[model samples]
Target: MSTSTMNPETADRSRRALAAEQAASLAATNDWAHVDKDRVHRDWHELYGEIAAAITAGAQPRDEAVQELVDRHYAIASRFYAPSRDAYLGMALLYAEDDAMRDWHNSYHPDMVEFLGAAMMRYAETRL
Candidate 1:
């Protein structure tokens, strides 16, 4: 199948829905307080590198990679921290505020939404 087969708009909508659900699930949990900050940061960096590599490799369909990254981060975050809607929203906002993240987000034109959605989901999963 071609990349064109995966409508960017539709994929973005699906990703956003997933993110919202994950965020809500996280909000319902209570495990964010004990999160290991250093470890989560390290893992985030590692995953970021992997994502960069995937893009560099010219991977045909990057959504899967994005999804996996999102899933992994969410799992890690949920395991590490306490559930707080404000904290989750803050983290997501922080990413948008960072220059590096902005660059990374801009690097992939049509896929940026997917990447952001994945990141949000990952953050949400941390609460679970």
Candidate 2:
């Protein structure tokens, strides 16, 4: 990992490329692609990014706002992943297991990986 911080412009550009690549990878393997990657990334960064900031500021996984964020997380992920609860949980786990995913979250906030996992589990237990 590089020890440099990404400026907003650079980060946005990098995120777009990464999103497009991941969409292509998913499509190549699964026979479908999410064409609205910019929208997806925009929402993910704006909404989920806010949640990560809240977590960093000491929000608990059980918080109502946090749970709502988890709901939004599941919804957005369904565009790129699967819509089932099982797939949602699997993705929650993958955030921790995948180096790129985990690193990307950590890049924005240090507590993000575990915080998001806990929030997703809580959401699954309470909602799904």
Candidate 3:
């Protein structure tokens, strides 16, 4: 394994810690008054699973079908924050570079984070 890559146990711990920190931050800034947390969670889980299946089926990041998936991903994300083009690309960077986020995404498929990041980048550049 690469020196930069954490071991599974360490990665899990790191992910949990990061999640806690993020949740705290989000709670402080976002009003959760009307949101259905469970439904949003389910939507994200379903979307991630679909994206994973697309990757496993050899879909390229710029493929039309893959772009459709990215569209849904962006729409869902916009419910929380509608990012500018640069912000969306920055998020793509996080998907591929953040250890905890990358590992969480990769759990769906070995290349899920990279695939999704590329797709998101493409979507941002061309569509957004």
For model 2, how does the per-residue alpha-carbon lDDT over 45-123 read when each residue is reduced to its tens digit?
8876798679768899888989888888878866765444444555655577679989987777887878877787667
TM-score of each: 0.43, 0.70, 0.73
lDDT on C-alpha atoms for all candidate structures: 0.53, 0.68, 0.73
For model 3, the run of ten residues with the poorest summed lDDT: 1-10
Worst 10 residues of 1 by lDDT: 1-10
The residue ranges of model 2 lying beyond 4 angstroms of the native Cα positions read 1-30
State the displacement of the C-alpha of residue 46, model 1, in Å, after optimal TM-score superposition: 0.8
List ranges where model 1 is wrong by over 4 Å. 1-33, 60-62, 80-94, 97-128
- All candidates in order of TM-score, best leading: 3, 2, 1
The candidate that achieves the highest TM-score relative to the unseen native structure? 3
Query: What tens digits encode model 1's per-residue C-alpha lDDT throughout 35-120?
Result: 67788888867776666666566643236665576566556655744335444544454445556866665565445434554445
Candidate 2 residue-wise lDDT at 111: 74
